[model samples]
Target: MFYDVFVFLVIILTLLILSGLVSASEVSLFSLPSETLERFSKSKIRTHKLIAKILEHPQRLLITILISNNFINVGIALLSTLSALRLSYAININPEYAVSISIIVVTVLVLLF
Candidate 1:
């Protein structure tokens, strides 16, 4: 039970970090000025050209980022719930209380970090 909970925590933390990185990328990429993009498009560097090419279809990038964020958030929620259930059963406590606590705690955590 302890190992299962630890694994769940590790996964949840990773997913949270991934979600944050994805969100940061969305902000940073979309916030770039037109001049910067233009420079990137004309740059000799392969990486810059690739970035410009990918950014050419802003709609697709936005959709992809949004989908990734959604999946990460859902995974965190699912793991939290499962861990909470495991905890409730292990301690012979009311499952609803454990689930409710876990939900509140996880939500706060996701919001805070």
Candidate 2:
């Protein structure tokens, strides 16, 4: 039981770090600081419009990144839960019960946040 809990913690922490890195990379790619822009870079404002134009398709970029990140996070959660159950020999436990409980806890915590 203790070992399973430990493994779950390790996995969760690893996934969180990975997710944070991905988010940071996305933010860096999309972020534009006005102070850092060149004096002659058209319009003089460091707006995302320039980035959007460069991307060729802005909406698709947002959707694809959002969907891909969500899929990865969900996959990580499921894998962590399954790893816990397997470690504890709790194979008979319902996956829905475990996942729903996790989702409920996360939703409540997010609301608090």
Best candidate (score: lDDT): 1
Structure candidate 2, residue pairs in collision? none
Top TM-score hit: 1
How does model 1 score by TM-score?
A: 0.93
Candidate 2, residue 62: Cα displacement in angstroms equals 1.4
Clashing residue pairs, backbone N/CA/C < 3 A, model 1 = none
Task: Tell me model 2's lDDT, rounded to 2 decimals.
Answer: 0.59
For residues 21-105, write the lDDT of model 1, one tens digit per residue: 9999999899989999999999999988988998999999999999998889889999999999998999899999999999999
TM-score of each: 0.93, 0.47
lDDT of each: 0.92, 0.59
RMSD in Å for all candidates: 1.2, 6.1
Residue 92, candidate 2: C-alpha displacement in angstroms: 12
